[model samples]
Target: MSRSKFFLVVLICSFVWAFVPGYLFQSLTSISWVCWVFSKSVTAQQLGSGMKGLGLGAFTLDWTAVSSFLFSPLISPLFATVNVFVGYVLFIYVVMPTAYWGMNLYNAKTFPIFSSHLFASNGSPYKIADIVNQQFRLDTEAYDKLGRINLSIFFAISYGFNFATIAATITHVGFFYGKEIYHRFRASQQEEPDVHTKLMRKYEDIPAWWFYSVTALSMIVSLILCTVLKDQVQLPWWGFLFACAMAFTFTLPVSIISATTNQTPGLNVITEYVMGLIMPGYPIANVCFKVYGYISMSQAISFLADFKLGHYMKIPPKSMFIVQFVGTVVAGTVNLIVGWWLLGSVENICQDQLLPPNSPWTCPNDRVFFDASVIWGLVGPNRIFGSNGNYIALNWFFLFGAAGPVIVYILHRIFPTHKWILLINIPVLTGATALMPPATTVNFNSWLLYGIIFNFFVFRYRKKWWQRYNYILSAGLDAGAAFMGVLLYFTLTMENRTINWWGTGGEHCPLASCPTAKGVDLGPDSVCPVF
Candidate 1:
């Protein structure tokens, strides 16, 4: 985003600022000042906690919290970013609080205001192991005795938004970009090569059959894994094909969004939901299907992004393909090896209940993943989102999602001169909250604040400075924060060292994860009373 003139200054400033929240003042990651003001009140903490609760009017100084899930706002177009802001305000401020407090949707007050954990009918933690038999299927007898699993209102509704996001992405792309894409395709096929195309064609080109052969080989192995190794994978051969088909279908539309907006809609939730609905009681099956369908499409978008960069740089297609292929192989292999080592080496990893407070190995990400498996695979969507599920009506979000783009397209037609009308992107808007479980509300608040400062104000008033240093600032901040993470891992995490001070102690919002329902006992000291 900038030039060499002020590059060093930008880098230094970015590093200096990132260092504050990255290490020294950790609680800056989520400063729910309202909670601090009303420090002893559970209700206040529940309403204001950025990490575990509603995060009402909360803010953060941490760039990691800002950039981790949302990516560099400097890179996103202002229109798309504005749409996200609108969606976030509507969902978080209006819809979420109303669903939880006013309507008491899904008995929301019975559990924490915002959490990812599953719960029993009486507000105890849902014991997944108790309801699972040796075959990894839900033991109907145990489930009946224990009663239906429940989720926090936020988790349940976030899923409904997931369905809406996926549907909206498809319909949005069709309404907005379908015609331009069709015409471009037609023109590319019919017209003679441009000078740049002719020049590019002179370079050594990768043969089409090479791609075909690799694809065919991958398919053969995948099919074999699903069929002959069905006992291991649990997903049937037909399910594997269906997953592939869905990925293929979604690849084009999702890529268009990614290529243009630098934001890609997640297919994991939708894929998992579908597999869970059709092929219930198979957790492994659901996960594999998600990995194939969601990851495959994601990789495709990544490849296209690389190709776009290569084209802009005039890199030969053959060279780009070879480099990408080798990089993929090495990266995949190393990731597996590192993951294997961590799972074996780490003690009581992901076991938050057993782990000491502030344990580095308490994996928030894995907690979300495990919860997904329980919802879509173990318990199945039938008992969660289907006829038997509490969220059956939330399925209407799919229709609401589809209709969103149509309404926008109509407005675009009527107010043709109002160019801003066309920029009301439904997909980007709806997907604004898609990363919430793993990405808390402070993330968005911090992100949006920075976005407005840089993308809007700086771009408008300090155009030249923004054009030169915006992206550079982002890169420097990310790199500095990442280096600090690695350093902390080696210096402190390796020896389980912690600086026990008020500032170092995380956001002081303990009651945020507690259930508010009356008569729910959470051990000896923690119990909810009638309000």
Candidate 2:
């Protein structure tokens, strides 16, 4: 095909694929025979949910991926992937098991090995609304009866670690770039000259006023949305402005870190922490506020990154802006549609009982998001990490996180010849532990193992061969996995068919993954219905 024709075909196909499964199916589920066919039996429903869940997981990986992809073209792909590999080992193999088994914190074994779902002391799922009074504050009487929130030691560590990393990232930037920051602050027009920036000098710069106007319009819309959705989201107008202010202030430093290190600090925990203090007792509002704040800032950075990439490639600024705007609108709409459909269709999303045995739609990420809403949103951190709280000791992790990098910096100065000292990034170490609730140990192990083989063993011994085939091989494998998954879901699963085998559930250690018993001694009030 000609180049234009090929591009046209690609665009058309992309839209069709995104729109069909996302919008058409979502809007026409009742009228469509496919939904009926898929929803016919217990097995079919489970399979459909599994397929949707898998598709979502695969796509979500691409969020962090594009930035890394940009890095590979500019630098070494192997280098970035290796960094990720190291993280998987530190968290999955080292931190998690040690915290759980060695420490016996939060009676780790009694609950699900890796779940974000909060349980009462009696072992049932904690219902926040049940304990709230008319004023939407925590009722001491009801809370005592319901029991306090229980967190796995892993979760507690991750929480503390996250806070520490945030502080560390800011400190790392400020300490290293204090001179440049001061220069910029003093209104110096001095620009850092890089080859990429120099190459783009011929193109006309996009106006700053255009960006400011767009930003102002967006803020207005955001304020309106927050106000209108107050009943559901509970975020007040003032809270919305506060979120926007936080996003605006943090975006620059966070984006700089992301650009240089391929590691962007998350604002979720920090946003939640501040909002929790400011808007205490309103869990839903806190979550909404955090999402609006953090995600908005992230989107801005992503857009800015794309603009930088476009400038380097000599793409017209107007063209880049248009494509980005359209793509974001389409992608965002499709995501909402698909997400809504799956949540509506899937039975027992995060809950275990009503779900089929080993249902893939366990909603690990959703569970985490929900739990955060409860912890930072419903029951404020003051209650959980306060002196009187059950796991107040976990608060020390923040101090550890902050002090860790400073110690590393000192070590680096003392042992100036050692390059490895620079690799001891406290943020990356904390990030490794961040995935446990939403990811399994098996995934961590497999990813690390593969990264080692491809990046270390093969790259070391067979540099030429690795360069020629590594990325192509990796891409082909990922494509094949996703293609086969969709194929199987449609051909067999949607028809209520499955290969009834030992490994069909995709779990190697079922008993260790989630709690098995029904009552408090076993873990939470929620029982493992399948067991």
Candidate 3:
């Protein structure tokens, strides 16, 4: 088939795939599988039932390997994955539990191990809206009365680690890829033709001007849109332009590192940090700036990745562009629709009090995002990392991150034969500590266990089988799980029935969602004491 025709077919399939479920599920507002599964009368349990959590946690592992492989093929992802597993094991198994249960830091014993919910000094959930003024700015008086927001040590560490990761990324790249970085910066550098580039030479290459034109046009559109929707997103036209510039500047450097290391460092934290510095005290604007700055670059890189793949396969560039454009539009539209539907359907969302008992839809990412806005946007980094703030110690993490890679580099230089210096990656370790709120202890544990068993044990002992079937097995598992999920959703729609089980309802790990240290009765007659 012609590239145009092939593009059309793929676009059509993508649209169909996105729209069908979205259209179907949009109207299934109040009717949820969880409501059917758990009885309203069932007493809310503390902590959780173990085995049930293991099942759900294990299923999500499919995307992990798939995503990692997509970043870089073959053994490139193994080192990063190993580092991640190590961090996961240390944080989830050792640090989190010890800090929460043993030291009782932040009064953690009364709350859950992992959460994104913001808490007050008195162990009550902080109502953000209550502390915001008419202008959407945080009211200092109200905030002070309610007290400084309390965070679990795990959550605090995750935030601190983000800064560490950013610092580490720059140092690590400088230390490891200094020569390559220098070459990339040099003028009149000749492009080395790889096998793919040589094969693609016969095909008409896409013009650089075409990409530049598209990007420039998109930036203009975004600028206009941001200006028009200033109140909605709160980003000024100048901020929008600045964000675009930041994205454009960082894209090449970040992509270069990702291409080599199989570990893609995100611009989210850096964007947020920059925005916080430039446009402090406007929470919405800060987040809006981040989305435009970070996600725009991410989206561009994603397209670039596809374009590279097309080049590798000797496919036409224009056709690849069309496919990506159509796919993005379809996916974004479907996602927005689903998000709207869920917002209307799901009660409370980030509000713990109003949420359904044992509700799984805690909006962990949203909570984190919102909290970040408060930290980096409303309060600004100065208070949190400055000498006066509660978390001033976290500021040192930036130095720690910078020093880590330099130390490793120095050690490697000193001991030329030792390879262990190359193995210690601060960025990977810090990145693994991220997503702790959205991902539970069980999730991390399961992922680590699976990685250890499969990547380490199986891949090590069974080399031939591993090389042949590793990705194939991953693809098969992902496909089967996705198919089953779709089938179940459709089946439920057809029969008008929902699965009735504690496992599906999230009652299996009731405490997993808990965020506060407030004394609440565990059961009908069980009053839990504050630790």
| lDDT (tens digit, per residue) of candidate 1 on 262-335 | 77898999899999988888899999999888999898888988987887778999999999989999999999
Ranking by TM-score: 1, 3, 2
Which prediction has more favorable TM-score, 1 or 2? 1
Candidate 3: tens digits of C-alpha lDDT, residues 1-531: 444454445444534443332223321211223323442312122122221111222222223222322221233456767777676666655765576657777566444444566666555566677778888877878877766666656677677777777788788877888787787668335867678877877767667887788788877887887788777667889998899888888777667656755566777877888888787668988998899889988887877878877988789777787788789889999999989997897667676556654444666567678888988788666655555456777777888878878988999999989886687776777667565555554445545555557777777899876776666555444444355446655765346464444333432333333433456333443233332
The sequence of per-residue lDDT tens digits that candidate 2 reaches over residues 1-531 is: 444454445444433443332222222111212223543332222112212111111111221122222222212334444555576556544665676557656776555545566777655567777888776656767877777888755566667767776777676666556678888877655667678777777667777887788888877987787777667768899998889889988888788667766656788888998998887778888887888889988888999989878977888787888798789889989999989998898777776546786465766677788779878877887778765468777767677777777888889899989987776666655654455556543334334445556677788899886766665554443443345446656765567664445324332222233443334344354323333
Q: How does candidate 1 fare on TM-score?
A: 0.95
Q: List the residue pairs that clash in candidate 3.
A: none
**Residue 235 lDDT in candidate 2:** 88
Error of 1 at 507 (Å): 0.5
Runs of candidate 1 with Cα error greater than 4 angstroms are: 1-9, 12-19, 192-199, 525-531
lDDT, candidate 2, at 516: 33
TM-scores of all candidate predictions against the true structure? 0.95, 0.76, 0.79
